[model samples]
Target: MGYVPITPFRRTAEAVCVQRARVQSAPAPLPVVSKWDILSELTEARAAFGLSDRDISVLRALVSFHPGTDLGADPAKLVVFPSNASICTRLNGMPDSTMRRHLAALVASGLITRRDSPNGKRYMRRSRGTATAFGFDLSPLPRRFAEIAEAAEAQRSLQEEIAALRETLSLMRRDLLGLLESLPEECQDAALTLSEDTRRLLRRKAGLPELRQREAELSMALTHVPPAEVISTEEMSTNAAEYEQHYQSLKKESSDSEDDPSWYPMQSDIPGSENALAKKKAEAIPPRIALRTVMSACPSLNDYAEGPIRSWSDLVRTAEGLRPMMGICRASWEETKRHMGQIEAAIVMAAMLERFEEIKSPGAYMRGLSQKAARNGFSAMPMVLALLRREGTAQYSPGRAA
Candidate 1:
């Protein structure tokens, strides 16, 4: 036999198996830092603000246990951190001197803010909902802070715009439906069921009464009466001979009557008259409805058209061009106007809403959350004091005066 040797394919197969086994045995990488970790650390320091250790423990437990109750209307759905007393009530403890100091340190570090209420002040924390979407980069602290402030402002403005847009779109749909309802009652049912807008229009224009009524009238007219006679196929053939003889006798009588000119009738003179008078009446068309479809979609400031026609005039021209193209009927123009008026009212409403919401908005919450995260994840006190307190060149922490 020829010299036998191990195939290269066998070696490759063994290597592949070993590699996959090694990969499967390897452990997964550790998870990235999350908001919960930062929150936990913030809660732990509640006592530094004059809250008791027990109060701090209670707060930690509430957020961990009942996250939903703490979160109110916030989109981020972050739970508000409870106060020392609330914490004590929840976890069963009393306030202490060091609790307030811890909270002050947390505040100083920019981890959390002391929120004021009609009742009193309490610490607030933000959930990760808003922050994770925006990745945190600390390289340019000053620039980042400025960007964050601007982004927060933009978010507020966008929310107001979204609410207004929803209201206007809803009105436009309502008006479109109302126009379809004004057609003949015959067409009203099908019009209501029609999905193709053009088909619905044609049906309304055709002026047919409801399909069911038409069907009923046809049914009554077609109702059957008892037959005068009945015959089998062979019997009908024999009867045809008899019927022809009878038909000729009747025809002879009609032929004699036809000689009298008075008995004949002209084609034009009939019960239902077709004339020029009716033709003129049919020619007239309904007046064209002039619709005003206001482009209630408020163009963003970035998208706001710029020029000499820079004001609402530019927007009006844009609206004029879009209206006819969209085929909105004039009957709904009033509704469109109402929609625009409502939107303007909403903008004013939003401004008022914002004033009250500012204290509880995600931006403010995130501002506190960012500070908290910065405090826990990194040391801002050293950096902040370094900038404020210069020791030779490097500023150190501003130590308490003994």
Candidate 2:
């Protein structure tokens, strides 16, 4: 017997050689499956093995050279003797230097083993129609198939959990914003602080534990809010009629004379009409002014709209779409519409959307507002005007034509 000498292009790492020997010596307990199947598993679990995209791409080229779809029953046939030229061509004209580095990476990762011939050239010798080859062997793929599949499944499960956590966080943010808008200014500072904290977590790509912690904090804040006062249906109707009558009286008085200073009589001028005056003032602002002020103050609302909000009707539609995202239950939303009318409810939703960052619980805040609207005490005019005043200039001054 003659001793055959072989030399490698580069010195093999001892750790890689050890791993390759271990894998090759291990019995094939797994079935001989298609190379594609093993590649799929490798791609999924690549991150766990510290494999990069280029490494996997090189592995894919190695698999393509296999004569059969299934790595043959004989372990020795797992070797593929494709020339470096063929590998570079399969890798989409990859540079020779780059191909060598990635091939070395594959060997170091223990996914493949080098079988260097005497001249370090890759080729197969046939003896009686059987390949006696020296090149890259893919036997490790079958040996590690079970481990790869398990790792892939775990990775998939983790991805699903992360996706679910993200969805929950989104709902929490929406609800918090809705609640913030509905809260009175006195209670808003705390909600705003919470909003900022939640935003920081989101920016950091927080995990489930952090998100849950923030959600619990927000829930606690909501529990401490004072309950909204409730009113019966009969009282709501009476108040609505009174409000309508007052508005009609003011409209008649204004149309009679444009220069009348008494269009909105002061509380001192009409002792018994204080509540009536407030109601009239609340409804007197034109919808256009309210819409412009809301659009300017709460520009975030435009993100929820499908098109440009060119009219009050468009603003209402955008608010309707955002209602559910804010965690306002259908029943509570309907109750608000019944008490305040659709336009009024929509206006309130826009304002809430505007101040959503400052509210703790949108659903609860909306419910509170609904209860007040049922008593004819909820007025969007004050809220809109307040936001406009905060801008240091009103878009339209009251009792003056633009």
Candidate 3:
């Protein structure tokens, strides 16, 4: 501790001396920790500590000169007395000035401490029964391991929370976009303005605070959304007739389509199920796409199906089996089928299975798609094609899918 320089933390060395005296008088030897493991934790928590890569690199080179990976029982051994040239060589020919600057950064971050000898040199002096090594001391690393680990863990949790929020916001944005598209063009309103603002905001990447604010604004806007337009009696009767005609056609396709107990939402077998399904039901346009086309896009669904999904009913059956596995409850699935048609529901289920990992709440997601379908008809082809594009199976375009 000879020729020590005066600094803001000059008392730090005094405190270290007191701690060392206590450590020397302890009943047991100090526990050793892996230097590399500490280095990795510090890497994650570097931003918190205001450390740079070059600072970490200097630390790395210093640690490598130690006998082994662990900072062991010998306290004096922790003081690495490497010359600047030796460290510079280890750092892939870094300039001496740059290395010195990074070393200062490490010292400022409390990851290391300077133990300069008389005349500002780094060396050890052997006395009668004791030795003193003057150099860069990494004893702080082992002492502050817990602090570094906590910082790293906090950073990790923050990243996870941000990721979850981003996904939630993205899902909400997609739903609002679909809803905006469903709105009547003649009706210009706040929802339209909000959608425009949302789109503009999305054009540039936003930070976490901005995202949170936008999410709240979008949620409030959605809650107060006005009805698309009021339908006259003639228009209502015409839409109702179309709904009935489509129901009849679906019934004709499979004799048990309406009566099937398995089809809970479309359970025309139950009294008044038709009224629940028919209310606000714009005519749903089913994507008459082939199973091979769907399978090529979503091969994961094949795992749930016992045999090949050769027909639309097979897809419905397969989707019914696959639905519960995705944490989607029966009631939500039933309502989705009620809002949209059965075939469209099955197609959505297939698309959901394809994107299982990315989607956090399959049930809520399906419900949003259902709401959009109820306002205007939901088309499954767009969802399917989007998935196909993501999977890089570009053979089937929108033109050919029709």
Candidate 4:
């Protein structure tokens, strides 16, 4: 071999060695993961973070199953964290670079913790690296979410039950009203008797029909008058003729009388002397006054129609004063009728409630009791049915006999 350029070769080898040493001492390049790659892995946590699908799915699963811990692994592992066995298993198929990139992503996401192992002897110990398990801490959030969802569903169901109960109660009220309307008019007295349960259900405003009838009868009694039977026309004619004959005889006797010497008429030459005498007697007592006096004296007149006026003068004055009073009385009567109607309706409602309360009997009663219990609360239905067994009507039902 030729010995030429030996110094130059030594110098070039030395320079190559320095360059290699510099490169070896320099920090390694950081791994890069594309947004598209992250988008492929999605999970609830990552979606909340607005991370891509692939990123969140991979990240959340990693945290849930391979959670971070307070400290990294022991120095024996020679890494910041002892890699999760499950993660390692899942990532085993991936290239080393990709696996390293995933770990960096987990670290950046705060899913893993890096620390020095407790057994470290030196402050700058290269083997002091450790990481936390991110999976354990975040694992229960999903379960909590599920529990909240289930509770909301239960609330919705309860709301539905309450709505159904309201509808049933409304229907029951309507049915009770119809029954009251169709009830026998003679049974009104029976229907008015109320139980405590019935009172609670039918408040005071429900008006009924019986009160209206009584009001009608009262109005008629106050305002009506029985008509008097008049005599036949033949008897009135006979009385009129007899009075005329007696009057003519008396006039003739007065004119014919001339026995006494001083019986001369002062107006004997006047043609209307007898007529003038008759007119004077009629003027002394007016027919209008006499008829009014008789009508006032009669006790058969309708007091409600007549009021307290006795004389014609008093009647006219009192009528003016009583117009408003009569109006007030009529209004009061109407108000009383309205209130009484309300009371009747309330009583009917009470009756229905009492009937419903009588559900503790055997056979038909027991069947009804079960149906009512079921309508109220199905969960308590079976227990109520059992307690109210079909031993007898007394045992199963609580109210009047059907």
TM-score of each: 0.17, 0.53, 0.49, 0.19
Could you tell me which residue pairs clash in candidate 2?
177-356, 178-362, 179-359, 179-361, 179-362, 180-358, 180-359
Per-residue alpha-carbon lDDT of model 2 for 170-284, expressed as tens digits?
A: 4554444445544665666576566545544554555557766777887776665456733344653444344233333443232233223432334542434665444445444
Question: How does each model score on lDDT?
Answer: 0.31, 0.65, 0.65, 0.31
Tell me which residue pairs clash in candidate 3: none
Winner by TM-score: 2
- List ranges where model 2 is wrong by over 4 Å: 1-9, 16-20, 26-30, 127-130, 181-187, 196-402
Model 2 C-alpha RMSD vs. true structure (Å) is 14.1
lDDT of candidate 1 over 170-277, digit per residue (tens): 232232223332344454334323312222222231212343343343233223211342234455333323322323334333223212443233343243555333
Candidate 1 Cα errors over 4 Å, as ranges: 1-35, 39-62, 65-76, 79-83, 89-96, 118-402
lDDT of 4 by residue, 129-215 (tens): 542221122212221343334544564554455444333333332222223223344432232221112222322222233323333
The ten-residue window of minimal lDDT in model 4 covers 1-10
Candidate 1 lowest-lDDT run of ten: 132-141
lDDT, candidate 1, equals 0.31
Give the winner by lDDT: 3 or 4: 3
